[model samples]
Target: MNDEKEPQANPWMKSLLIWVGILLALVLFVSMFDSSSRQPDGTSIAYSEFLARVDEGTVKSAEIAGNVVSGKLTNDQSFKTYAPSDPQLVDRLTAKGVEFRAKPEEQASFWMILVYQSLPFLLILGIAFFVMRQMQKNAGSGAMGFGKSRAKMLTEKQGRVTFDDVAGIDEAREELEEIVQFLKDPSRFARLGGKIPKGALLVGSPGTGKTLLARAIAGEANVPFFTISGSDFVEMFVGVGASRVRDMFEQAKKNAPCIVFIDEIDAVGRHRGAGLGNGNDEREQTLNQLLVEMDGFDANEGIIIVAATNRPDVLDPALLRPGRFDRQVIVPKPDIEGREKILAVHMKKTPLAPDVNARVIARGTPGFSGADLANLVNEAALLAARKGKRLVAMSEFEEAKDKVMMGAERRSMIMTEDEKKATAYHEAGHALVSLYIPGCDPLHKVTIIPRGRALGVTWNLPDRDRYSMTMKQMKARLSLCFGGRIAEQLIYGADELNTGASNDIQQATDMARSMVMEYGMSEKLGWLRYRDNQDEVFLGHSVSRAQNMSEETARLIDSEVRRLVEEGEARAREVLTDNLDELHRLAGALLEYETLSGDESKRVIKGESIGRDDAAGRRAAQMDTAGSSIPKSRRPGGGWDAAPQGA
Candidate 1:
């Protein structure tokens, strides 16, 4: 019965048709009334008398009919008559005057009225049809757009970043070049039965230009590049993530031999079966679909997936297997030369003064990444602007570099005069100790003025890159870390030790603990590493179990660490005591200059006759204590003879 019922007409059209019909009916009714109201003589007459005269021949010249009469009058004039046709109307007309006239040709016919009324309906139907058709078209377009991959495609002309635009990643670039060549000529390698890698994973810490490298690949290959974030896949709805993965792959396949780069893949590719609760189930599903698409039945399709993640360990192992990601590129922190190149790249657009040196800036920033270098340049330019300088000078960059690494200099930080003096002497002690320690890098600068949260800072610039460290180097560093507190105890008694040495103490303690527990540099422990448990936590849940260790061994590890720190502290006190007068002189110089370089501090320690290299050699020979569990032999015959001692 429901199917048998015909659909109702559209309300919008029905109302339009009804209004048109009413207008036509009103026009016809008005025309009929006009035809009945007037006489041929242009004068009103009683309707009954007029009808009587029309019916009788006394008014013989007028012919009478239903509501109409026409005749030739006695005066030879054409005439017409009008009256009510019914008997009831005739009775009413006997008391009322009425007149009539012939209807004009301009009055429309019934057929014409019907045609005029239906015109509007036809016009409305056409307009409604056009609107509905347009809406359907737009709806289809919108749906198609939703399934399209959000990856940005960049052609050669559109991509401004190329291999030349990238810096500080020479090895990564060389590896990526193979992909670029494959994109340029796929058949060359295909003819030799060599299949291009399906994917390459870029793993590194944040701000290391993983995204920038992907762009360079696209620009170099001159192919369509698709870039999207890992988070783009997972949506609130179930199956949405998988659907997006399918859509993304479909898009990449359509643009065959293209690169599809996903940044921060860990967002979707977290290790399955690790996360607690059902919240991550959708993400896991998305990751599963991605794995299938990467290495399933259609694995060798021309699409090359490039993904980047800082936390590669958290990614699904399936995704990183041989057939899936295929290759993993580690973009670690830049080294000295890499840093210099990165600094140079960022400095190109900066308005640097003639004396500004990229090498100096690179040397100052030790652990900075490519993004950090860019930010450093921008910060230097800002400082220059603040000073109203025409160009960024070397001094501005120096200040900016310090601001980036150590934080902004707080010259206005308030402290008591006694506190200030104590800080100055403490920093001077650190400088003095580092100066006399062999294998310790030369001091870059020592400033008693407060910077960031630090009451004072002693900057040590390494003479060269040292990938490996010996026991002498570690012990020397420990002594330097303890020197500040040692100086306070010696000059102003143990009561003078303030919170200023908190960071130094913590660092010294950590080093001591690592030496005893991890590095096995303790005499009694003898090559035993106590640290076995190292579990990483994600989202407040432990990803793995901790290793078990006995309480007795833990106590022994603690004792060894404490012994190392105490011995280092005693040595610091002894060194500071012997150099007390020189320490005072160095502190006084620092108070005057607000900063003392490594060379100036060394001059205060040994005078002009003792060159930096000679002083370093002497210090190395003096620190060779027997029975001390120094990890490596400290001999002056090696490259230690070449480095400047203090600076």
Candidate 2:
């Protein structure tokens, strides 16, 4: 059943075979019809018959063409014969009164002779031309582009972005100011017997101005900046990446005192040999070349390499060693004052009303980065424009902020009265629990409006950014997350509890599981964190099937997670039981207005104006003290700090 068709021959081969066949056929026909072969039936009276026919006047017509003579007999018989060099051949033909003609010797056509003579030379020349063109085309990109560096050079003319242009990362800027000084006055450091560090790395979460700080360094140093992505160092070709690495360093050497910045450096700088999967040979070669270049270059050469990546944990240790990226500057999310500064910087582009204070906006955006602030300002301006307002007012900014956090108001998403009441109660329950919990984030806003995939949203914005979280706050958050489901069970009974709190339960379950497995919060696990050692360099997830524990440990982990969730639910129930009247009041307010701000929520819950948040308690975070509720297993030397102690 082999139905495969045989492969066909090349068209040129087929055409050449046909031409050869035609030539052979012509040769065979010429051999078969050669004038030297006498016909089988013809009489062999060559010279005598020719003389007799010429004398008898039977040769009616004759022609002498070069060597062979052809004539027609009077009886209409044709024959071809050669003529000897007879001086009176023409006179003899005239005497016999026979019609005869002699053809002049034919000369070869000029163009035909030229073609036959030059064909070989023409073929050779055409082949050479085609081959040379193909070679040049390949050299242009197939070979040449592989060896050229892809870095873009930004000189003083293109980049004027100094440290002033960046905000919300003051610590990083200060950390890099020395590098700037080193680049500007290398001799000063040299005279002091201090060698400038060859490299610095910027690491942080996305949108935290990591790349911006690198540009700011180049601007402040007033040096040529070579900008490229870590990916630009890699190519599909085997040796191209290594060649590019050499090329880039050579260019940087030509422009001494320049700064080279590779943004998103994890693309080529992942840990070697044993992290996520088997290492890539091409990528490894490029990395090796980079290592060689870094070692070969002198620290006093005044060229600095600054790279940025969000995944510093996955970078190779060899890259971060001393004399390489010796300095690691952290660019974190903005704090209250930093957010305020960033907003003011972005607000300079837009006309704003006096009532729209940047500080107020900063207080509301605790974890916002400089980029987020810029986006927020843009959204506010867009809202103002949509309303044809001359200036972006406080109301517009507030609406935009609300829209950013909870998503755009879905007024068109119609709901029955019962569904509305259920959503209202659910949101109010979250706000109410957070209000009573001492370590919980301050309850900011609650709304029953549908946004994204949620039926309602409850915002709990901290007054400031936090670096860590404590066990007490985590447990409080777990209770706070499940408060909606608890509320539904309390008001509508277990049978009537809908799927609105399904997302809440799932979140609570995952948090509890993380506390047990990754955070070492379980007593039975005994400070043993069951987390994968694998790290993904490119932000993709990695799963390592390297569990060392037995099935019993897994079951215990599941049991512990369930206990945490149940305990949190019981706590929520107790809190709601004691303040049923307040919960009802909050739910009622939500039903009427469909939204409640921090002040309104506080008034509904505590019957008082919104006062200062628990900053005093927050600043005195007792991570190691007995006052902390985190399990000792979870708290390694001490507990995790839930907040920036004095920040």
Candidate 3:
């Protein structure tokens, strides 16, 4: 995708040319001095033939040096030959009236001798220089540029992203708009004697559009934007990182009113004293330099430093204090309305079918970040294109959402009839239990089709965005988690239960323990929290990972967790036992259809048909009106092999 041309002076090709030139010079030097093996451009003959030519009176002239002979015949032809050590050869040549002389050996000049003597040393030095230059380039600094900053200045021509491109984080966008305004008209704030914020720290989970927001700020202000990763500042050398930090601030001062964004700042800004290493550690030194640069004696008036980190808890306190990072912008995951806005932004570039609804998709995706929504839109588009459709449809969006939330369907995995039936019953139990539970989420889907690592999945969709859980909801969730195992135990006997409930058991245990210890829901625990502090032990803090409670307290906590899980299991077993016929009906529907939507599942539990025969009739009508070219199951939600659904 990079259209830029390669540099003309390719290092690989340059090294090859250097070696070739050296070899050519060496060959030329050796050829100049060695005259014994040198041959003249003439016909070759034996030594006796040269003498015979002289005797026959055909010799005009001859030359000899180091046992090599060259001569011209009277007929004006040239000849050369190698001669043995013969004492009479010179006398014979003289007696035959053939003019002959001993030619001197060629010798190299002073410059050539000097070059030849120093060739190896020169080659070694050249290789060393080339290696050093490559190393410097890899370090992102040229030779003697070890202290130079690696921040790249982003320009408008490099795919400019304005405020219009950023969505879902409206509050964050509004917060940063003032900074952009300050950059455009600094006099506005200056006249009021109010200084613009020196820095802003964007705190958020991953994929929350923090970096995108930074770029949008630069685009809106129309000022220079210098961006670099925090890791780029640190190097193996202790002082290199600090030197780079100083150099970066110096560049920012030159480009006043520009935004300097350091992404993943936690890399260099982790708490210094918490590490095992001494104060001279490279990362700690870099953090120290950054602290001074942000809020030091020298006022960096127009330079605004914007940094992003997911782990703000681990950052150095000095870096996050006021005057350094004046504003801490929280870029949380988008809610329903925010998700709709984000989807609308991404959908602008995509060709959508009339049925495609952004609000519905947003509502379906409860906790999707802006990036997740964008990927969802992209995945929907990909699915439509894969199906040879010109525009993305609602069904494609639904399928794409399922893929993003759960995982891709593994229809290629072979399953026996009994396995499929067991999985259907297992998923049916979850769906049925959720429907009957008082505070449980709405049953969105139940499927026997394998997705991700699960043999079957029962999905629940919240009617509204939930920020916290209530006690009733927690108890209902525990029962829902145990539903699958309980159903298996009842139908196939307790001893024959499969390992499909392993994840469910683990989740149930964690939630119950969290309730008893962290949430303080256990009446016997007397509202006291029993959770342990989790620290970064690898960073040399909190070396001991042992529990904070006594053995008796630990035993009590375990018993409480087990009691909650058992109560949940008992509740699920009671519900399933009472509605045994309904469970069978739902499981049978799942086995027949392979997947069911929320409404269809409700219908099946109520002892009603899901009207699949009517859908088949519609497909048959389509086949009759059109031709046999279209496959029966090619559409997203058509035919026998329909994709799984969510609320």
Candidate 4:
């Protein structure tokens, strides 16, 4: 994805090349010492043979030093001999008509001489040459570049990402469209005395297409884009980050009307002293410079700053103020409609079977981000390829969604028959409850085939994206969640219950607690948030995550959560009891198939004439007429809001 020119490797490559050259020079030096041994017809001769050769005038030339002789013979062969302590050696050699000469008085190996006499100087020169070459090779990227802006400059033509390429988060796009218009024609807004916002901050969860949106803004405006990460500004050296920030802005000003996008800006924009380590970290200095640069520039300068981060809560207060980041665009998870568009964008080039429908795929994905959709498409394509299919099919998409949501099918996982049977019943319980429970999301699929850590998985996709749920819907969700556990209790009894419901219990408890403590649904807790969860602020609103409650109030909250879970369990128990025969039939179907579709579940629900208790029947009939608004008593740990009229 990073298409930057493979950074000037010449610098490091030059250093490596120098070391190689030095190694080669050392190898040559070693080879030069052995050069004499490579001569042709070289022979060893004793002193007597040397004397005879000299006497016969067959010795052409000879050199002697420290009683050792070396020379080429009359036959053009090279020879060497030792003449140890002959008092008349020189005189005798001269008298025998041999050309004789005395060798150097040092009498040491030439390589030794070179090493001892000149190695240090040569080594110093080589190191100096290496350093100089390294400096020249790394002319602009190390110390010099530490303070230089590392922003990747993309030209108008190179930036192919436009608003068309991005879907989902339509509101976010609308928010940035004005900036694009302003960039394209400043006079349109200036005529009305309107000033463009100095900065726009994109805050959202990860993989929500923050960076993609930023690029789309740049591409739409058709201006040079400078893209850099927040971490790029920070360096090991103090003040380097600040220097880079100033340099980056100066460059942006050079290319006027350009957009400056910083991804993951929280890296440098976090509140000071909030993190551990240095008191005046480079990150802090960089943030200060960024603040000054953003403020120093005029709103009419045609330069707009855009930053993306999920952790906006931890960002410095100054950075988020109106004058600094005038607009805070929230890029939330895509709704069903937006998800379909995003999928369409990613699937543009993909070959799909006739059965593939973007809307259907989108409906199955409730909370997927743009990145998730793209990944899902890719996963489906991969599955098609693995199965040797030429085109991706809806079945492949279904498999991919399951893989993305519940993890892989995990067919390799081995389980005992008893365990599989229990899992089947458990999953059957969930499917049946969801199928019959009004206001609950329709069941999608149920499988005893284990995936990830779950021994079985039951999937249900919501009818649509709901911003708020009715009380009836919440109650239905409660019963659906507890259906599995209640089924286990009914089939195996209390004595034979397994630990498989651990996750279900924890999730149900958390849901109940959130409803009571934060949602203020509990009558005793009233309409107040008993607990504050300290979290990042997005679009001018902060969801407090910090706890704010008395110990007694906390105890009451715990009791309320326990009461909700128990109530859900009791409701599930009653439903299962009324349809005990249907439960067995469904469990049998699940055991045989190991998987059941929603329609298959409905088929199992048909032909069931089980009768309900009088009170339950009256409540069910009343629920059909009521508007899903139920009133409860003022007491804590109490069951559902006031029961249906007849109950």
Candidate 5:
């Protein structure tokens, strides 16, 4: 896609050349009018000489008619005298230091007159050439841009991404297809009493193909597509944004039956009253104009508007109301099938091993979007190249997937023996806790080997996709998060707990807060959202409002969260304590294998009492628990505890 502005010539130099040419033409015209007439008596005097002779009085009453100077001269004794050559008169004039000369009128070349007249033209031409060279030197590439909009127009050939190029956004594509149809055949829809939708807004997270879908719409429509970012309308100058908006709409109207795609529309379409600075007013003005252009009474027909934004929540309500942006399509991360399709699309150019399965890759990358899949394919190709391989193997794809999803594997990373041991136990603690938590998903793999920025990773794969989360499931997950810290404290005492659980602590705390304040999971809080005062911004503000709860209630909330963590920790410590020997054995095995499969992990968790196959089967059976296996009382304790401290 050609999203960049086109190269331009120097404006000042071009203007200078034009002005110089005009000046030269005027100078040449004035010089051409200086023609001389010949006197009747056969001798011709130059126009300048004629004027001088009239002033000098060398011949009285002289009539210089045509090419001849025929006039009677006052003499000592003479009535009329005419001489073609006056040798004595010439000698007398020469003595007086006056020079008189005559030449044939034909000798005065028009070309010579033109050359003299064009002096200014020649100077200007030289100046214009010099100025052009100087402008080129200083202007670089972009200089003739005073009025032109810096929008890149991507034709179908340049943007090869059709609907087929996009993956993981099936619903969004289906919604957009209606717009495409309307553009291709508006009469069909109009015959059914359906007015073509003026605009469609694509909302999603970054890398979710919002912008890509817009391009696809343009390509599918097969019309002139004008693309500019929302930020392009906004400028420091007041009314600039509004003017750009007007100009953009005008351009779109001229190219009627075309698509206008704006990426990141939030730049100008933000809520009017939400911004903090002067620029907000201008942006709001631009947004208002856009709303009018999209749905105004006189708005042009067959002109479709497509805008993509990650933060649709922050957009002006007026902009999203019925007529302006009637349809909002959400392009979310691809599901398993979508992921598989996306992977296939990306891997078309990559040479994959025979064993490489798009389904397997898709299944593994649950949250990956189309862009991420493309990146993954490219990364795999690069990895294969780095390894001096002719084709990207399944293993290479796996490595690339891991690298993109999680950071690069730190195989040669230096860690002390104590650190390594701590990491192993910490990871084991997580796996063990998850194993015991009934509602927690089944373990996928556990590795103490450094990967990305982590010293270890414990991956849990959900049995199926889940869109909603229940309180019980949330609490179980929170408990699992605290398990690593708990195991560290139990085995290595207080000194064992480290920053390894920083992310875990944060995640667990947020969940607990949401449970108490937002979810109303607490007995006292009821179903009300305690923190209902929104920050006026989308998704709430970065900073929270002042605490509304009393000091006592605050303390209680803190105690509840702590109780939840401690309970989970205590459970982890107990599980590890019971399987202490197994934990050590597994840790030793991990050092050798660098990773452990779900079956191997289950075997280690079950200890020597069960065989590997039996352990796997038993673990699978345990996973069938309805919700969570932990008893209500023993459930990773954290909510408000009314009982006294040690009770």
Candidate 6:
């Protein structure tokens, strides 16, 4: 890629240039008028001296014009003087035998006179107009264009992205392909008595590529595309949003058979009167105009409206009705196969090593979306470049995945021996519990190294993509959550346990409560949902969503949640007590290695070594070669850096 230089002129420089031009024009106009009124340069004397000269007949030939007089002396020298209101001035010149001639007074041309009169008004008007233009530009549109549409027309010159460029979410893509087909050949649907869909609503979580799908439709149809955000229509003043909506539709009608994509429609299409107090009148009015444009009495045939939003629940019902948004397409997180395809698409741009397997990476990231896969590929390439590698290897991809999933490792943070010991035991407890539990996910890795905000982490991997959880799985997960606390309690006395398990305790409690209240998994709650649906913070207190259950029932709910938690804690303690030796062994291995993969952890629990002697020997050799200049505490086998050389 080539580097581009910045333009020579900046905004302030342009403003300065404009001011300079204005000043120059004012100077030129002033000079024109000044030159017309200025008196001729010549010798000047008083009116009395001029009269004496005229009486002496020294002024041979006097010339008079307006309020000044100029003539030549008898010696052929020129002189000038101001004349008073003397009626006999001309007669005196005549009697003096001065051969005077009275020239007609000079007058400006008609056009020059008009210019002198109107120059100041023109300058004022020009300045005012320029200032207004700058203000309107800052306000997003010109002064006369507040009501005009802000939708940007997209063309091939802007870089076209077609359906071929989109990957994953095939079902959503297939749903929209029909709209593209109709756009290309409206007669096919028309001949079959089928009317084209007025609009298609793309709903999904953020980063699911709803906007990308809209662009693909425009590219496939080969028609004009106008893109705008929902907030673009809204203004602080009332009626402006409505006018913009009308104007946007007008532009779309002028370019018939085009697509207009509104991103984040929930910004303007939120349900009216849902919140407490007065709603946003301007936003509501804009939404009303948008609704009318989509499905009102006027038939906007040949025009297609495509809108995307993550928060569809907050959108007004009128905007999502049959005619307005005829189809609702869901863009969900990609599954394993979809992930492979998405990774493949992004990997095409990256130089990959032979060991980089898209399938393996896809299986590891079960719930990744198209955007997430793209980011993963980018991060892998960046990691390879940072390491000065020619191509991205599988190890780089794995490291990138860890960074994206659990955050980068914080090796610079200092930890005491006691802290590392406690963290190792805590993570070991969770891993040991997961290994013993019936329905727990398989343990992937356990580490005592600080990462993100945690002192240690025990990661678990599901065998496949799981959409729902069984009651057994939920109970097992609850036990897994408490295992860290239970291990801490067993290693250190209950009173001596650290705050390492605070998050674990909170997560377990919430899960247990959700199982009872929301999932209706508890016998006490039966098969009915005890959770409130209304978002109180969103709707405010004026709208009541309080569950009408009695105080007794609330107390029962609390007791049930506590009972489930206690049961999980008891189960975790039982497992840890039975496998006390294995817990100690795993924790000791973590202290030695600082990290253990699933297989390594299993081997450690089984009383098998993972070949650490060779790595230790290599580190000792490097230290010896470096001599005694290095401090013993800061050596390879010292302090927190005591891990094996290449581990």
Output the number of the TM-score-best candidate: 3
Compared with the true structure, what per-residue lDDT tens digits does model 5 show for residues 347-423?
A: 88888889898888787777777788889999999999999998888888888877886678888988886676667
Candidate 5 has a TM-score of 0.72
Error of 5 at 554 (Å): 2.5
How well does each candidate superpose onto the true structure, as a TM-score? 0.71, 0.70, 0.83, 0.80, 0.72, 0.78
**Model 4 clashing residue pairs (backbone):** 532-544, 532-545, 532-546, 533-544, 533-545, 533-546, 534-544, 534-545, 534-546, 631-642
The list of candidate 1 runs beyond 4 A from truth reads 1-149, 155-159, 278-280, 538-546, 606-647
Candidate 6 pairs with clashing backbones: none
Candidate 2 per-residue lDDT over residues 1-647, each given as its tens digit:
13222223454565566557556655754554463353323323375578778988888888777656776788877776766787777898989898888778556578756755665575567556555554555432444366778888986656488888888788888889999999888888889799777889998998888888889898888889999999988877777888888888888989988998989888888878844434557788888888778875444376799999998988999999998888899898889888988888888889999899888898998777777788889999999999999999998888888787667877898788778777876787788888887778987888887876677888988867788888888899999987776665666554453455666777788799888887878888878778777643455766544368889888888899999998888788788778766766677667666777878787756544334343212222332245533223331121111100000
Please list the C-alpha lDDT of all candidates, in the order they appear: 0.72, 0.75, 0.82, 0.78, 0.69, 0.82
Residue 381 displacement (Å), model 3: 1.8
lDDT of 6 at 572: 86
Q: What is the lDDT of candidate 5?
A: 0.69
- Give one clash count per candidate, in the order shown: 5, 2, 0, 10, 14, 0
Q: Per-residue lDDT for 80-163 in model 3, tens only? A: 998888899888888888898997856668987787678768767877776776677645577577788999999965889999
> How well does candidate 6 match the true structure, expressed as C-alpha RMSD?
8.2
Candidate 6 structure quality by residue, lDDT tens digits, 485-561: 77766655544544556677788888998888788888867988777776555545543254779999889889999
lDDT of 5 at 493: 58
Ranking by lDDT: 3, 6, 4, 2, 1, 5
Root-mean-square deviation per candidate: 15.2, 15.6, 7.9, 9.3, 13.8, 8.2
| Residue 249, model 2: Cα distance from true site in angstroms | 1.7
Model 2, stretches more than 4 Å misplaced?
Answer: 1-144, 156-159, 275-280, 297-300, 518-525, 532-547, 605-647
The reply for model 3, stretches above 4 Å from the true place, is: 1-38, 41-67, 71-79, 82-139, 533-547, 614-647
